[model samples]
Target: MSLIMRPATEADIDRLVDVYFSAFKENPINIRVFPESSPQSRAFWKKNLEGDLKEDYVRFQVMETVDEPKTIAAFAVWNAPQKATNPMPPMPPLSAWPSDGEVDVAAEFFYDIERQHKRFMGPLEGAPEGSQQRPHWYLELIATHRDFQGRGAAGALLRYGEQQADAAGVPCYLDATPDGRPVYTSKGHGFREVESRLYQGGAYEHVFMIRDPRTSA
Candidate 1:
């Protein structure tokens, strides 16, 4: 089936949410490894995506079925330079967050992977929430619907983001998952062989990878 890529609109968020949740459902490693399961993770991401989409700082792209308007294939986005973004809810005692989707879904995500791999996913550094302005593009999220896996939707989304970066004359960067590292490397993104890493829960290591769209664009 043919797919069309375009700027994601508010009308597409529901489908985007469905695609994301479906992808996560299809990847149990992501579920058991992540901290957002138990019924509320879906709602958590929905809140994040919706709030981010409403922000001028966040940009998103989605691929949809050309033949079936009801279907969404995948979506990718960059976010930062936000204005007073959502704050993390208070955490429970004696926990970085929670193994469950309690204080923060994102942190739960970190816990999921950290607990699974026994390594940090990336450097534990970020500008204070909404306080730092990102000069380049950040790949905040990307997901291909499980139904559409092996169909090149991820590559399409990557190319689309790079095109945007090229048009803006900026580079694109992302904190790559172990599963995503080879994929991004195949597309010419390079890892910061140095400090762009994390040491979480002890030995878990998450590395960062970036693409200079100026070259590949």
Candidate 2:
């Protein structure tokens, strides 16, 4: 079955929420941060994604099957290095997240990652939407629908992000889960693990990786 990658639109949000929950249903971070297993959980995810979509530097991309009435097989949320002409607004503090979403656990996990992000990439600067010292494309989130995991849809999205980073002569970065580290490091992906850190107060961990831009000889 053929798969295609393209920019996701508002119309795709509902389906994307489905893809997200279906894909990450078993993930540790997903479980810890989004503990609600009810309809309210789905609603929270949808609202969160909707907010992310409205941000200037955030880009939502999807990979879908080629058959008619195509299914969204996988999706990625990327944070492009901000341009001065279109700077990103500050994000709300984790404290502001709804209690139903397990905001405390999410804050613990995300704050841990933010510590690594700042140490390795430098703090984010508002002037142009990039790190103070090292600018790079950040993969904020990615998920493959359970039915399509083995079919390479996620790889296509990774390659698509890599192409964009290569075009801009910048590195691509991500925090890879235990289940995702292998794929990120597989041949052709070029990601090298730079650090491993525990999150959720040692309940789980994620690996930070970077793939430097390919240069012509």
Candidate 3:
């Protein structure tokens, strides 16, 4: 089936959230961190996706099968450069999630995971003082619908970011799940692993990788 990619809007939030959750529902680390599958998880994902769609620096895109144009096959959340604003914000508090006790606990558990991620990625997040740093595109999240896993939708989204970053002469960065690292490293993409860490007390590992601009000279 043919696929088309386009920017996702607020109107697409519900479907996009479904794509996100369904795509990651069986992911080992995701299950380990948020297993209860409560409404709180749904609400948290909705709020986060909405915030991303509203952010000027974020490029939210969805892939749809041309055969069924309304069906979202995959989606990507990318962070590009924006002037006059701080793109990085503090992690949302657990209180921001739904008030149910289970949801609150799930939110807290994921927050802990976020903290661990920061600890592993801190050095890459900034550069040494007095050194110039080139802005790079960040691949925050990318997932294919469970039914569309092998159809190349996710790679298309990654290539979209790569094309933009190449044109602008910037690198690309992502924290890849074990299932995704192979795709990111294949097809001459040239992503190199810089760090790897186990999450949820060694249940799963996330690999941080980077792809330098092919247009760099």
Highest-TM-score candidate: 2
TM-score of 2: 0.85
**Tens-digit lDDT track of model 1 for 1-217:** 8888888887777688778777767343355434445445555556667777786767788888899454789998765322324332121232432256434434544544333321222222574554323345667779988889888888888876676777776656666556677777773544342224444343344546556646432
Task: Provide the clashing-pair count of each candidate structure.
Answer: 12, 1, 0
lDDT of 2 at 158: 85
Model 2 lDDT tens row, 53-75: 89777778899888998889999
For model 1, the run of ten residues with the poorest summed lDDT:
115-124
When superposed on Cα atoms, how far off is each prediction in RMSD? Answer: 6.6, 3.4, 3.7
98, model 3: CA deviation in Å?
A: 5.6
lDDT of 3 by residue, 1-217 (tens): 8889999988888888788778888776555444436677677788899999888878899998788446889999998844313334356775675554345445545565455444433444356543223367878889888888889898889988998989988778788787778888886677887777775567667788888889655
With a 3 Å backbone cut-off (N, CA, C), the pairs that clash in candidate 3 are none
Each model's lDDT: 0.60, 0.78, 0.74
Rank order by TM-score, top first? 2, 3, 1
